[model samples]
Target: MTNSEWRMTAKRDKVLSVSAPVPPEQSIAWPRGKGRALLPLANNSDETIRLHLRGEDPDSACQFGFSLPGEANKSSGSVTLELSPGQVLSLPVSITPPPPSLLGLAPQTYHFTFTVINLSQKERAWTVMGRLKSKPIIGPGLLGVTGICLIALFVPLYRFIENRENREDAFSATPAAEASEAGALWPLLNRGVEQSAPQTPQLAPPDLESLTYEAMFKEVGAAYNLDWRMLAAMAYQESYLDPMAVGALQEMGLMQIMPATWNVWAPKAGVSDPFDPYSNLQVSATYQVYLREYFSGKGHPGNKWMLAAYNWGPDNALQVIESGADWGDVPLHVRRYVLKIMQTDSHPVLSDPRLQESVGGVRE
Candidate 1:
């Protein structure tokens, strides 16, 4: 069935045969944070057909989700159902927003591939898109906050300046100060203002911390057969890999290793000082090895999950997995942390030249 208001973004090519044929168009776009649309399909074959429904998005901007019509819950990737011969079905799909970022300087579009599969394993696929419109680098809300601060700062300064000017006028224009024993002559007309040299600020020198730990990262990575860039990205997220850095939670050194974590892992890393670069990286690398294996053994293997486990805690990441939800279910901070690590100089979006030479984190 076709509706007057909605446009058909994609359609299955040829009649529905034993082989699943994918659609020609793989990309679709709409202008908003969230979107809802209906995709209609028909089973034209002579026999009853059981079809599989699956949905996923490109790696570049993957903050999207899909659900069947009237479904109570939307799960990640795929769902299953049966369609009788000559039957027609209307599939309803919805997309969620991408991660929050100041990079919303331009419209952000995400693509989700919707596929319908037959028992033959051939499938019909369409790339559905949801667009998030561009936002100002400094939105009105931030501007309003800045304006409020300026008003607070300037209003008092205005009054202060006025009061000083008035006091000076009173002192110079009137003879009361000259007549008083305690007050001396207020010289206004005969005096010239003295100019003084500006004082050099007494700011303390910043700490000298070694930022290059690439060699150590490579050594640890080769030992574990893991990508060194991923470790470097994690290090950047932790403390920008600053060996001398300290966190509010008393997390010390390059990896911002916590006191409790250090106690459990210090002996294994063979180090006493968390501020030592190699020792700190070694401890972190050891912990990451455990994380990687743990997630891989869970049958949900990926760098994203491992990083999420590291940042959000392994138990929390496991809960998300057990819950059968998508990445959207993760908290914003964890999602952001994972996204930053994945995006490198070669990333389709959010790239930097300096991010090159790293082996892996978020692969393109």
Candidate 2:
């Protein structure tokens, strides 16, 4: 009998296991006005597995479909794929939001399911639930009010500066002796002016060397449905939660994501600032999910390869794996990076509750 395992690649570095006979239901949120999001499904079994997917409601406001590479017929209601042993088939499931006219101003929900059958004809199914919500739009009235507030705040400061300059010009018009007397008073006037000057508010700098962003790391992990400990471990290894940290290779932010990779994932993650703590964590999590999927699809245990790929680049990691080298045989720097992340004493991010539960309260 061939043993079979199933996994779903949702984000970049994350994969959710699917139980046999009946997998647990999963939920996702979709923002309105955005294009369809891609969900990757994989089969990690020794026996060939066939998949059949369909939606719960045919006349629902939302639309569902599948994209299979090399297959001429890509249909929505049903699609079939014969996945070989240890082979992963990426089934792209697309969700089309309902028109604003039909959806109105409220959020909506949609449902779908996928059924899988193995060589022995044992069948199992999994459910996908989605909530469709529209992005908030700023109205012209709010913009106008904000503009008026800015004018009210800055106009007086502008006039105050102008008046001060005019007064200085008048002072220069005084007689030499009067100017000399004025010069004696200049010190007092300068003191007064300095005391009266408005101070610009400054932002407090980030505590880079500290584990202050532990909550943020856990939040991003939960958002991506990943183990928080893994995310924390990676962040601690990369930048110790320092958003301003920069690697020698031009890698930026806490997770040390490459510029090129950030550019590809920023839009998908709704991140405008790569250096923001939340944005950095979000992008890094997404990239990790992709890495997990890619390595798992290639028939390798994703943990070690995923870490190596994150540190040494995906191509290099793949090359090392293809060469049949163990994790110790990987490049020295990559090996060290992977080991550091897997080590618990390296940082305090593992103390978080989510991470503790993920690793089963064990520290290694």
Candidate 3:
């Protein structure tokens, strides 16, 4: 899966009145889902400014060109311009139809973000969105997308409702305990000081040891409210504490993080150096929290589900569950992987004794 639309964020708050495609399709996308139009970029501020402009397509469905002063259409490289007050420049945007593999039955939106920076280095990002709708019974492509959608959407709901009934029955025995357990569903979201904010000032890499993958893991786990020992076990399993480890799937560094995973979480953790021990740990920890939260919402909480989801892709893990598989029915490798990590959860650690109780139990 490519970067989701939610990952695209603006760099600043200043406003720009960027016009949409010439004839905007407010109802549906263009006929063949291909559109070419000039988007207006107007500088409404009072100051005359030198600006640098570039565009990004997380959707990978669009091509961009800039019309500079002496250059009519410049593709590929960013362009520089000096715009006085009330000056307007046009950006040519072309959205090509997405390939069949990129489509999904629940509908997906595509984003093309334009970023502009002034001489003072004040940057801002503006984005345009195109949506793809579901067409069932069209062919195998649509049918396959529908099948994936059912697994992604319906199965999760079924698990959630089923878990709710279980929770109600368990809580029936004790009123006080019920209220307390109910809040576990959103521990970080309900109240977390620095964790909830997506934009974090870059936390400096720890200096204990250049080879200190353990220190990096503990630091990240503490910041994210995870069990440091458990996280360390995951790293030990993935890379054997080797900072330069490379996985068979092209995943890199201490955590063996996939390139796609790094692309999604790097910005959230406010780091760019993929191979740096601390940077790698930050991405892994952040994604772990996301995965845990996602599984919790799907009615599967605790380390077993979280670790299983981490080992196998969450979709595959859920598919196994939706197929009515028990722990014995999980793929042998995944079961062994999760069991090893859980076994290591009780290992002693020196970093923070306070996180001792954070090692989670497997849901029944």
Candidate 4:
């Protein structure tokens, strides 16, 4: 069988399998300004599967981008693709080079890995590897020549200046009387300044629990065209503003997001540390936006369904909605999560003029 059509027989029912052509062992030399490439994937199993794709380049010299099956055409670092049994697909993978200004004199080789995970079986997955070569605008040979010329020009001048300065220092040494006079003048000039200046009291660090993280929440929420208050409320409900809090399911940081969620959305949100307050808030807001769009496409009410999906996974939330049940009919925990956010006293976020306008000035 051709590489594209190679299949592995299923050993058990409800098993999902995937196969892809091995990436070339030799590096794929990407030109400085090139945009992207396509990677073909095939689902060779009896079970339908969801694919969560994530890419990482240690040096971060290039941005990896892809689009999911149901998402808009925009490229992101993380995307979810649904593959039916016996389906073959060609997915576009984009490699965005660093800006010309950021490139160095020497050529750069970026090694990246794209990890594909079956969401249903988190532990089962595969990875594809690729390399990008970015040739420098000014090659190393030219740079070495320039450096040698600069050193040749400055070395004599530096030596002459240094010798002349030493001679001057030897000949123009300050007299003892003059030094003593200068020291006397220093005390006279500074007399009573220390006594006259008022003391400024030191301020203590702000309490972590009381900190609103308002600026970060507002920025992230605005980026996704969401209400800052709702985002703040979600954070408050999730971890009570504690960036280091851990949930029962091992969810970490202020948003209580699982590591799986972090792996997928952190790249898309342009965040490196999910434990950081700002990064956590940004990733959480991005996931909220995705959930909102996904549920809205399924004919569910945007606000309530989005909140439900944020608590329970989108798949479960949609199933409840499809069964003719509204937000009130959701599971107890999810209902409580939605109700808590809706009733939260978000005075701080609501006080902002931009947020006020976005939510029609609603006050709880």
**TM-score top scorer:** 3
**Counted clashes in each candidate structure:** 2, 8, 0, 0
Q: In terms of lDDT, which candidate is stronger, 3 or 4?
A: 4
Worst 10 residues of 3 by lDDT: 355-364
Pairs with backbone N, CA or C atoms under 3 Å apart (clashes), candidate 1: 26-127, 342-362
Question: Quick one: best lDDT, which candidate?
Answer: 4
> What is the number of residue pairs that collide in model 1?
2
Q: Write the per-residue lDDT of candidate 4 for residues 1-364, one digit (tens) a residue.
A: 2222222311122454333312211112222253344455666677787878877778766676774454454456777878888776656566666744333555566666677787767657677665555556565644655565565556545655665577588775446734554454444334434433322211122233444467556666666787777887777778776665656554766788876687677656644444456666777877887888787788864678888887888779878778887666778988878877876464443444442222211110
Q: Where is model 4 more than 4 Å wrong at Cα? A: 1-212, 344-364
Q: Tens digit of lDDT per residue, candidate 3, span 241-329?
A: 65545565546666778767776787678654444556677888888888888878877887788888777888888887788877787
Estimate, for each residue in 84-192, the C-alpha lDDT of model 1 and write its tens digit.
Answer: 7787654444445453355322434444555666653355444332222323345454465556556655655565566558768876534453244222122311121
Name the candidate, 1 or 3, with the larger TM-score value: 3
Question: How many Å off is the CA of 173 in candidate 2?
Answer: 94
Worst 10 residues of 1 by lDDT: 19-28
Instruction: Give the CA lDDT, 0 to 100, for residue 154 in model 2.
Output: 60
Single out the weakest 10-residue window by summed lDDT for candidate 2: 20-29
- Model 4 earns a TM-score of 0.40
TM-score of each: 0.37, 0.39, 0.41, 0.40
How does model 3 score by TM-score?
Answer: 0.41
By TM-score rank, best first, the candidates go 3, 4, 2, 1
What's the best-to-worst order under lDDT? 4, 3, 1, 2
